[model samples]
Target: MNDAVHSIAAKSAAPLPKSAGVTGRTNDPARTMAEILKVATHEFADKGLAGARIDEIAAATRTSKRMIYYYFGSKEGLYIAVLEESYRRVRSIESELNLENLPPEEALRTLVGFTFDHHNGNQDYVRLVMSENMLRGQYIAQSKSIQALNVPAIRSIRDLYDRGVVEGVFRPGVDPIDIHANISALTFFNVSNQYTFSQIFKHQMQDPQVLAQRRANVIDVLVRYLRA
Candidate 1:
């Protein structure tokens, strides 16, 4: 009986009904699960764990909470599932970039570009993750599998730093962990507090051209700071 478990159990008990006028029989449990997850992800992102309603999720997916529980076990479980899948998709995309093959400078540029694009394009994902972190990652750290997904991104960045140091392209003393934190902080800040940032700066950061220019500026700043 912790608050998290209690929340999950409450959601599990009250399931919603399916939508009307949608009569289709399909043996695509996988597709159904994916659809549910896609809707759930947005709900969780918009509301955070505490505020997200299972009924809302059900309505969005046109399914019942029982079905969600049947597939994912509980709301906590569903939240973790959404996060793991999201991380997997992002990691898969990062893996394909193959920064290891590029020269140090080019690899850094590509990596930064990808990070910028990811945060900008997937603002919901960014908000979801920031909310999780703000909660001290209590839910996310519970899953070992989810934690393991970060390894590839970490290793790739480390490799880039190593190569850069060897080639005299970057300052020799930068720690990979520190570098990663800086990059995340820079990219996440603009999106995470877009409203506040807009209020303070008196402009919309959501504009596509503005975001694109910011992305390039971030890459330039990082490159200049790291380069020897």
Candidate 2:
């Protein structure tokens, strides 16, 4: 995404051979990649794609730069990989929610609460999302699997809403995508605008009490809107 890192891909001479070094290189390649991603995620989220350095990530991961490239293909490739992993992680956890077993209203509330907790606890996800938007979503656009990764989120809403309507618990004719947009908007704003909003409004949005109230409000707002 950054012009400076654009050519880093072409500079990759070749794959790196495994070596015994603290470069985070080890006999286990998967573990090495995971270590790299863990460090790189913070680096990229903190500094963004343009400012993030492979050398810094390499140092942090104790893995060679060549090793990083060998796994991801390029800096951009690694960045995309990071984005994909972030989305995949949240979605993967969401799928295990097993909302189908709960009543529609409780399921919706649980989902909203979980979404809020996730956005609050995983500020990295929100920051990465904010960083991506600042780039006008160009890097994320390069990612082919991102869209597919998010499909289940909307599908989950659709399934719940359909069941609710059939049971006469939720109102009919609500678009699942619209419901999803509302849910995300409500939860996402808490983390994305925390600092600026706090400074501007003198409200400590991150305070546990405040967050608890906001969390309740988010769940109530959606439940009220969806219920028959």
Candidate 3:
């Protein structure tokens, strides 16, 4: 991985306390918002939209359902907030790669490696995202913030594709959006469905060595396909 990607992975993997006050007071609005989001993420991941409960989130966060409503407006609003926040965090990490500065192949490798590491490390986030998509993204699209966060990343990938074509590293016919979807599907599907994947494959999918090999294979395939 490149230095930027490595830096982000390191920061994400670093251990964090269960609760940290963003505003230096447990009940401060910012701190409370953070706590509520953390709890909501876990709740949504463990239980799909149909299964998640605001009351459980309130109790887990040591806050009230009224406070959650006051802060996020509604259950759908809270779900959107969690989705937006999750996307923001992932996008922030992705932005650090600066693929514009690297050669085409190296840039592709960096992106694939970063994506694989991210999903592998944050399985719960992956589950929550997949669960949302399973519901056809009705909730996510309602969040203007989530919609807005996607433009920069999409533009960045297009810029990279342009660069690769100019350098004769990738075929001129490739669509940037297609490339993005391919990468996302490859990295996300297996991890998001690890339990079923393991059952089908008849092995423990959580083995560290197996995951490392999977990441390597994903990068190799993506790089070869782009270079071809």
The numbered model that scores best in lDDT is 2
In model 1, what are the clashing residue pairs, if there are any? Answer: none
What lDDT score goes with residue 181 in model 2? 92
Two-way TM-score contest, 2 vs 3, winner: 2
Best by TM-score: 2
Candidate scoring better on lDDT of 1 and 3: 1
Model 1 TM-score relative to the real fold: 0.87
Instruction: Tell me how candidate 2 scores on lDDT.
Output: 0.86
Q: Residue-wise lDDT of candidate 1 within 1-228, one digit each (tens)?
A: 224433543444443335322235353456667888899889889999889888888877776776777667788888887787788888889899989899999999999889888988888889889878879988787765666788888899899989999989998988888888888888887788889989999888989888888888999989998999
RMSD to native for every prediction? 5.3, 4.4, 8.8
> What is the lDDT, from 0 to 100, of the residue 141 in candidate 3?
62
Question: Quick one: ranking by lDDT, best first?
Answer: 2, 1, 3
Q: What is the lDDT of residue 143 in candidate 3?
A: 64
TM-score of each: 0.87, 0.90, 0.85
Model 3 misplaced stretches (Cα beyond 4 Å): 1-27
